[model samples]
Target: MPDLQRTRDPERWDEEEPPTLTTDVTIEQPKTIITRNQSPDIAFDRSINAYRGCEHGCIYCFARPTHAYHGLSPGLDFETRLFAKPTAAALLRQELDRRGYTPAPIAMGTNTDPYQPIERQYRITRGILELLLETRHPATITTKNHLVTRDADLLSAMAALGLMVVNVSVTTLDRRWRAPWSRGPRRRASGWRRSACWPSAAYRSTSSSRRSSPHQRP
Candidate 1:
């Protein structure tokens, strides 16, 4: 697939209405869910992504380039078209039950946001968290969405046992950049407020970009 580029001027966001795009979801049944990596740059070796593609439509999303592997556009298609792994939890359970499977912190939202809008309906991320809690496995999460709080009960339980940590990514605090940058309703204040509900030891606030300026791209 060829590289495709799409750009929008934030200044014109208010002058013109954004195009309406319909979201399409497809259920994917994969042989496995836990993805293992040996990259020296990343802290975690294994991770789980319950869904493919993101509805947040962040123009600077690093995951957009990944969609090209499926012959899909890394532009609009990366946001409007999505895939859900309904069997994610089952596959994870199978792997964890394998012989000599040593436990390590499994990361979520490393490639895509686990708490994206579809998560509310599919609840695959929630299911994964539930399983991790049941097995007393350690896990870490990173997300910009506030929906993660919906699973606070499960997360809190895991945190109390020292099995989990949650990181909320705040890209920019400026309300002017929120909509144009992420194309989502998540506000910087809301992210901080929601993260505060969790224990300080288990909660962390991170910035995806080094600079909070609108000119800086992720």
Candidate 2:
């Protein structure tokens, strides 16, 4: 809302730079990071999201609807396109330092996965976690990617101090159902096929099948 230009002169709009056709980089300095929550089932009051769109390209993604506000096509743009908050780490630390700041657990990966692929290069989320670790602030995270493993040292240290927890979401354990959903992403993106929801071959090789799809609600 802060950067948007409001003008009565229609011609001025034409001179504005259009979003790039495809980008692996985007830098936005949001004014705030900790979003207040009112959900009854959630356990935290604030959350931080490092990126605006996910490139995972999973069709069932519930966050896909948010792309419309950016005038982007939620279909392909949500995958090939993305947004980054390079200043989020600094903003978060400032917020946590506010005069009356009370330290309550902050949640990450609530609305968007912090470790989503672009994070490898941007490292905004990593910077944020480092700040939280240094402050000894309690936090919780839910993510489906193994990238979190890269920060295991921080997480393990936080866990030892009773300041952090992680919950990994695995949508399905079915081989056939998971296979169809997984294949569409493999050809376009490398390094993802192995982590697809289907059981690792090692697991499949060691045990008998236990997959079963549930009946749909009529």
- Candidate 1 versus the native: TM-score? 0.81
Clashing pairs in 2: none
User: Per-residue lDDT for 1-218 in model 1, tens only?
Assistant: 99998677697646644666788999998999999999999899999999989987877688899999999999988888899998999999999999999999999998789988889899999999999999999998977777887888998788789888777665556555564425244453455465554543222224553532221111
| Candidate 1 local lDDT, residue 139 | 95
Residue-level lDDT of model 2, residues 1-218, one tens digit each, is: 57986568676556433243455556777899889889888778888889987755666678888988989888777776788999998999899999999999888887678887678888887898899989999888766666766676777678778787665554444433342223222232222332232221111111355443322211
C-alpha root-mean-square deviation, each candidate: 7.0, 13.9
Scanning candidate 1 in windows of ten residues, the lowest lDDT window is 209-218
